[model samples]
Target: MEITILVFGQIKEITGIAAWQISGIKSTEELAAKLVMQFPELALMKYAMAVNKILIQTDTELNENDTVALLPPFSGG
Candidate 1:
């Protein structure tokens, strides 16, 4: 299974793209872990993920066509 991962901010800079395809997701937490492994820089930043625009926990189940967004911490008050 393939899923689309959308990156933002420094994540995009490190990963070098705003969107890309990757292996299927087993668990949300695993997804983050895999990304961090692929892009070591991600491990040093604060990030969160959303599935299909819904904020989900690490255990959230991902579907084949799920859209996962990787967002770095935002600062704008």
Candidate 2:
């Protein structure tokens, strides 16, 4: 299955892309591991995942065509 990942904040800055695609992804945990493997820079950052517009925790099962958003911590006054 193919999944689209939306990168936000510092994550986008590190990846240099607003969005990216990955195939053969299963659970959120698996995705996180793979991301850290592919993008080593991500290993040092904290982030949240939103699957199909819904925030998810680790080990969340994913489905094909789901949109995953990787969001960093928000900052403002």
Judged by lDDT against the true structure, how good is candidate 2? Answer: 0.89
Deviating ranges (above 4 Å) for candidate 1: none
* Whole-model lDDT values for every prediction: 0.84, 0.89
Over 1-77, each residue of candidate 1 has an lDDT whose tens digit, in order, gives 77889989888999998998877576788888898899898889887789988777657877788889988887888
Candidate 2 ranges beyond 4 A from true positions = none
RMSD for each model, in Å, please?
Answer: 1.5, 1.1
Predicted structure with the largest lDDT when compared to the true one? 2
Measured on C-alpha atoms, candidate 1 has an lDDT of 0.84
Per-residue lDDT of model 2, residues 1-77, tens digit only: 99999999999888888987888998888998998898899999998889998888657988898899999998887
Q: Report the number of the highest-TM-score candidate.
A: 2
User: Where is the poorest 10-residue window by lDDT in model 2?
Assistant: 53-62
